[model samples]
Target: MDKIKISNLEVFCNHGVFKEENVLGQKFLVSAILYLDTREAGLTDNLEKSIHYGEICKYIENFMKKHTFKLIETAAEKISMNLLLNWDNLEQIDLEIKKPWAPIGIPIENVAVEISRKWHTAYIACGSNIGDKKKHLDDSIYALNQRETCRITKVSDFILTQPYGDVVQDDFLNGCLELKTILNPKELLTCLHEIENAEHRERIVKWGPRTLDLDIIFYDDLILADDDLIIPHIEMHKRDFVLKPLAQIIPYKRNPVNHKMVIEMLYDLQK
Candidate 1:
């Protein structure tokens, strides 16, 4: 990835803990490193193909002036997220804010906060056995799409599937969605739980009936296991419900753990 750097860009904004400081306002030094592919622009020498630094600088100034927060941490977080949300080509950002006029009596050069953030790809499986199954699945998708940090890139058509465990239940509407998120594994799991609970999902019995069920099937080819979560989801390749939808969107996607393509696994399962 190519990089763009903007350093020591000054902005006057009102952000501090003290009431007087907020009212008086202060000068802040902002720096940022934007990560994106610049090969196309380099080859064509076209300004349209790359990020416009001048525009981004003005945007930074406006954004900082538009909002007021007590901590630079919050300011940086909001700025970074907003940049990612508005800019399609930006893949990651490293932002730094320097408070040279901090009210601390102790003599110090400056107080600053720097943070790095990026987007990650994750695949999630959706299932529901009770109530309006299609509505349950649809609502889950809608909720995921509504989250600012998450973007749904693809979705497979819902398929009817028998219950997995021994508990007797009606057929489930199963599907999968390709999600791009800024949240890490644990945070993403938490978001999924929120969506499930919002749809009134119950965990009374193992793999039992529910209004909605959301499971992390994959997280960037990551191989992981813990007391609470597992990745490449245990035995996902063997289950038609999981494999079928996964194959539809990512047939060529390789399982980092199993070392096999999604289509290959689905074919073997079908055979």
Candidate 2:
């Protein structure tokens, strides 16, 4: 993680709640700390090896001027997302949008909204036991990639596996995918649930059969447990259907909780 800083680049933009402010644009100061690996650029002494700060400055100015939003918060968020998506080498961004000409009666210097945004890698397990299993899995992958915020980076070969729970059901088509997304853990979970619902998934029993099942097995080496969802998926290590496919794509990925790689977990389950 290396840093490239841009300070107090001023721009005139029409972003405010008041109508007058929108009609007559105001001055705003933009700043950013871009996170990326600059080693190659430094060693090679080539501008192509790293993001060009001059080009980035131009992009930020153009973005700020072209969009009209009511809040600096919105401006900051949109800018961060655009910068990250547009720059392949950019890993993270710390952005700040300062509004100096506020309508507030107080003598405050300025108001600003600052935020940090980045891409996150997540592992998702997909299972389908009913109605055109392979088709269901393929469709789910397509749906996930349809979103601009999410991309399916890698996929494991779908394997036929026996049902996990006591409920007698047909063999399931199970697999795993590596997802690169800007969504947070909860947001990503919501996206998964939406995809499941679209595939007519029902949760009538504890381990009931379903048209589609999408679970978040891992989120960026994160350990999380909430009332609704858990990261590293509570029982992922014990299930071969999950570990087997996961191992195919990211065998060396370690569980943040147990510190076991995917291959080791699968070996343990088989043992």
Candidate 3:
């Protein structure tokens, strides 16, 4: 990744907790560091292949002026999201908002907030065992694709597999997807849950039957474990249904927790 940085660009915006602060407006210092791959532009000397700082600055000015929010935190968030969404080449952003004029009775020189946001690559496992299983799986993929902030980069063909665990049920149609998302892990989980609910998925038993089941197999090689979610899917390498499709899409994607590639995991599970 390479960087293009901007410093202390001024904007006059009405954003504050005090009434007069909003009415009179105040000066704000906005700065950003855009992270991206500049190799294409560097090789060809093509401006088209690169991000235009002028346009991004103009967008920041216009966005700050057009929106009124009480907290600079909200302002920073919106600005970061807007830039990430509009600029396809921008892989990440580090933004800072500085307010030189403070309404606080104390003599503070400035109030500021800084934030970083980036796109994450995640692999998702999709499975269905109840009613029109294939349709449920396909519908889930369509739902994910519809989100503006999420993009489906690759998909494995749906494969039929026996149900895991002792609970007897119909066979499942399972698949995997390579996804690029601006949504953070928790946000992405929420979105997946919404799609599962739409398919009338039920969670009566652990590893049990369901109309649709969507799990985050991997998220940017992140190893995370909490009450609601687990990365590398908590024994995913032991499950053929998961590894079969995962290897199809990303055979070389490593599991940060186990230090094994999808291909290696697939073969190891088979034996």
Candidate 4:
């Protein structure tokens, strides 16, 4: 990844905890480092291939002047998200907001907040065994794509698979999808849960039956285990239904926990 830096672009805005501070604007210095691939832009001498710093500066100025927030942290977070969303080629951003004038009634050089935000690649497994199985799966995908913080990159064809667990239920329609999102692991899980709830997914039966079942298969090669969720799906490497659809799209994607690719897992399961 390459970097484009913008430093100390000053803006006069009303952002403070004090009432008078909001009435009388204060000076703020904003800086940013944008991460993206600039090699093609350099080789082709095309501005379109790269992010424009001049335009970004203007955007920052306008954003600061237009929005009023009590905390600089909120401003930084909003700015970072907006920049990444607006610029299709931008992969990550480091943003900082500095306030030179403080209402704390103390001698201070400056007060600032800095944050780094980036897009993460995640793989999800979709399954449904109850009524309207295919529609449940499709609707789940649609719901995720409708979110501004998430984008569906690729989807595997849904395949019929025997249900897992000893619940003795109907066959399930299963598939996998690749997602690009700004949400973290927990936040992503919450979003998925919301979609499942919308489809009337029941927790009464464990693998017995469901309208929709959405699981996080992999999240940026992350290995996580908590009370609520586990990464690499815990048993993904041992499940044919999971590996089969996953292999169709990203056979080479390695499991962080087992250090095995999706294709390798599928082969091992078959044997």
> What overall lDDT goes with each candidate model?
0.93, 0.93, 0.93, 0.94
lDDT of 1 by residue, 1-271 (tens): 7999999899999999998778899999999999999999999999888899999899999989998899999999989988988889899999999999999999988899999988889999999989999999999999999999999999999999999979988999999999999998999999999999999988999888999989999999788898889997886987899989989999999999889998999999999
Cα lDDT for residue 68, model 4? 90
lDDT of 3 by residue, 1-271 (tens): 9999999999999999888988999999999999999999999999889999999999999999998999999999999998998999999999999999988778988989999999899999999998898899989999999998899999999999999999999999999999999998899999999999999988899989999999999999788889988887997988999999998988998899889999999898878
Q: Per-residue alpha-carbon lDDT of model 2 for 54-171, expressed as tens digits?
A: 9999999999899899999999998999999889999999999898888898898999899999999999999999999999999999999998899899999999999987998899
- At residue 261, candidate 3 shows an lDDT of 95
The TM-score between candidate 1 and the true structure equals 0.88
- What is candidate 4's lDDT per residue for 45-105, written digit by digit as tens? 9999999999999999999999899999999999999998999999999999999997788
Candidate 3 lDDT score relative to the true structure: 0.93
Residue 51: error of model 1 in Å?
1.6
RMSD to true structure for each model, in Å: 2.4, 1.5, 0.9, 1.0
Highest-scoring model, lDDT: 4
